[model samples]
Target: MDRLDIIREDETLEDLQINGFSVIQKKEGFRFGMDAVLLANFAKLKKRDEVVDLCSGTGIIPFVIMAKNSISKITGVEIQDEMVEMANRTARYNNVNDKAYFVNGDLKDKDLIKTLGKVDVVTVNPPYKLKDSGLINLDDRNSIARHEICCTLKDVVEAASILLKDKGRFYMVHRPERIADIICEMRSYNIEPKLIKIVHPSIKKRANLILIEGQKNGGKFLKWDTALYVYDENGQYTEDMNRIYYKRDDDNE
Candidate 1:
C-alpha cells in the first residue's frame, strides 16, 4: 500500500505552496493558521542549527521552517498524540523524516525536557487565552490549542528558556494584548526580548497579533520593526505580507 493512501478519512494533505511542501491537516480539529506562517517567517534560523518547537500543533512551524531554511534538524514537541503522529507522517510525506521528527510529551515534563536536550532555537505558537479568561472551545482538541488549559504563558516561556542554549533565539506569535505579560515572562526566565513586530489587519485597524524574538542570556535592547499590515486599503494582501507567505526567497536575499 502507498504511504499517501494511509491518510485517514478525516485528514487531508494541504500544500504549503511557498516551498512545495504539504502537511496533513485534520478536517475538524485544531488546524494551522496564518499565525504559524507568520511565526515561521519571523524566526531566524541557521542552516546547521538545531531547533525545537514547543506546542507544535500538527508541526506547522517545523514544516514551514524546514521548507524555507536548510536547518540541520527540528524536533516538534507536542502534547497531543494525534498531532504528533500527523507531524511525523508529514515528515515522511515530505521525505524529511530524518531531519524533522515529532515527540509526544508535555512541555512541562522533566523527562520530556531531558529528552529534548539543548537547542539553538525554540519556536512556539502557544495557546493565546488564559485557561478561564475567554469563551473556551467546546472541542477538547480545539480548547487545548486555544486556551491555556494545559500550559500557561509562563510555562511556554520557561520551557523555551530551558531548551535554548546561551544566546539562542526564542520566537513566538501571540495575541497583542498579552505583550506585557509575554515580555515579563521572557525576562523572568532570563530570555531577553530582542525583537518584536506587530501584525495589523490594515493600516487603520488595531493590531491583533505580535511576533516576538527573545534571546537566552542576551542583552536588554529591543528592536521594533515597522508595523506589518496584512491588508491594504484595497483589501488585498500587502506586498510585505505576500512576501512572507509566498515569496519567501525574495526576502531572504
Candidate 2:
C-alpha cells in the first residue's frame, strides 16, 4: 500500500529517527510522548522474546522496541480503531508488518486477552490521571488517552498479568504520585516490582514520572536505578536524555 494512501487528512507521519521507522499520528489527538519513549528504553527484551503492548497508542512502544531489538514478534493492542489502523499501515509502510502489527481490541476484554495468549514481555504507557481527578479533554480521543475513562490502573496491571508468561517481564511508565497504587496492583496480580526509575524535569525539580519493571512470579527484591533528568539547569536536554533520544553516538548507553 502507498504510504500516502494510509494517512488521513488530519494525521501526519512522524519519523522515529531509528531504523527508518515512522508512526502515523493524528495532528490534534494524543500523540506519542517522551514518557512512551522512556518506557520503551527502560524495557530490556531478549532477542527471541515476544511482546504485547497494552494501551498501545499509535503503536509507538512496539515500533521502538522492534527498532532496537530483534524480538520474535511484537503486537500492539489499542482500543481506538483509528489508531490501530494507522499503526498497522505505518508498520506496512516501514516494511516491518510481518514482525510488528496492531490489533483493534480493548485490553480489558476477556476474549481478546485469551486470544492474545501468553507473551514474554508486556509494556504499557497507560493513562496517568484518574477519570475525574483532572479536567477531561474536550476531544474523546484525547480524553481516553489521558484519563482512565476506558481503563483504570488496576485494569492495566491485570491485563499485563494475564498476557505475560511465567517469569515474563512487564514495563510501565506512569505518574510518580501513583507509585503506591501501582505497586499494590502489580503485587496483587503476582507481578513483583523489580526495578524503579524516577524521571525529573531537571535536577532541582521533583520527579514527575516513574518507570517500573516487574517480573511475573519472580522474587520480592526491588532495585532502584539512578534517577533520570530530562533537562539541565539551563533548560537543555541532559546527556542521559540525549542518549535516550539517540542524539549522540553512544545511543546504547
Candidate 3:
C-alpha cells in the first residue's frame, strides 16, 4: 500500500493536517489537491444541509464543509481507492468521521447511488480538460483528474440530477468556454441553472472559469452576473476575494 503524506498549508489550513492528502491513480488516472478547497469555498454551504460532493478527491470538500458548517452531513463519492483512503484519514483527523464518508466508484455508475440516498444539494468541481483538446499528461493520476476520461460534463450534471431531490441544488465550477454546453445540459435534465458567477484572473483579462448553481426541477428563470476580478493588475488578491477566502470584512470599522 502507498503511504500518505500530510499537505501543510499556510493561511488556509494552518495546522489542520491533511494526513491522507495526495494524488491517486486509478484505472482512469491523477488529480490535484487544491481542487478540494476551490470547490469547498464555492459550495455556499448552509446549516443542516444535506450535501454531497461528487468526484470528491481526498475528501477535501467534505472536510471543508464540516469545518464551516458543523450541522451539515456530507457524503463524498470518489472512484479512486487511494483518494478514499486519504479522505478517511483526514476525516478522522478532523474529527468529522461520522459526518462525512467516501465511497469508491465512478460518478456515472447507477448501483452506487443506492448507498448515498438523496441529498439536498450536490457539488462537483469536475474534470475540466477535454481528452483530445489538450496534451495528455503522461502521469495517470494527473491526467484523469483534469481531463474528462470517465465522466464528461454532461454526465456529471446528470449524476447530480439523479442524486438530488426535487428542488435540490447543484453547484459546480467549469471552464468558461463550456458555459453554453453546461446551460444546455442542465436544462435538458430539468435542472434549471439559476445562479452563475464568472471567474476571472484579473479585471483586465477575460473569464477562464465560472461557478454555476442550479436547482433540480426548477423554473426557467436564469439569474447570473460576473464575480468580478479576483486579482489586481499587480497579480495580488482583490478586495472581494480577500473577504471571501479569508472571511474578513476589511471594510468594517
Q: Give the per-residue lDDT digits (tens) of candidate 3, residues 1-253.
A: 2223333231122232333222222323243444355556667666778888888876656766666565468888887677887677666655567887888888888777756788888988888888787678644766677888778898898889889999999988888898899999999888999988777778899887788889999888888765757778777778766655553544332
List TM-scores for all candidates, in order. 0.94, 0.95, 0.83
Return the clash pairs for model 1, or none.
Answer: none
The alpha-carbon lDDT assigned to residue 212 of candidate 3 equals: 88
Ranking 2 against 3 by TM-score, winner: 2
lDDT for 46 (candidate 2): 95
The lDDT of model 1 is: 0.91
Instruction: Please give the TM-score that candidate 3 achieves against the real structure.
Output: 0.83
Distance (Å) between predicted and true CA of 152, model 1? Answer: 0.4
lDDT of prediction 3:
0.72
Candidate 2 residues 107-176, lDDT tens each?
A: 8897898798899999999999899886776458988998998999999999999999999999999999
Off by over 4 Å in 3: 1-38, 137-139, 247-253
Task: State how far residue 17 of model 3 sits from its true place (Å).
Answer: 11
What does candidate 1's lDDT look like per residue over 13-88, in tens digits? 9989856799999987778999999999999999899999999989999999999999999999999999999999
User: In candidate 1, how many clashes are counted?
Assistant: 0
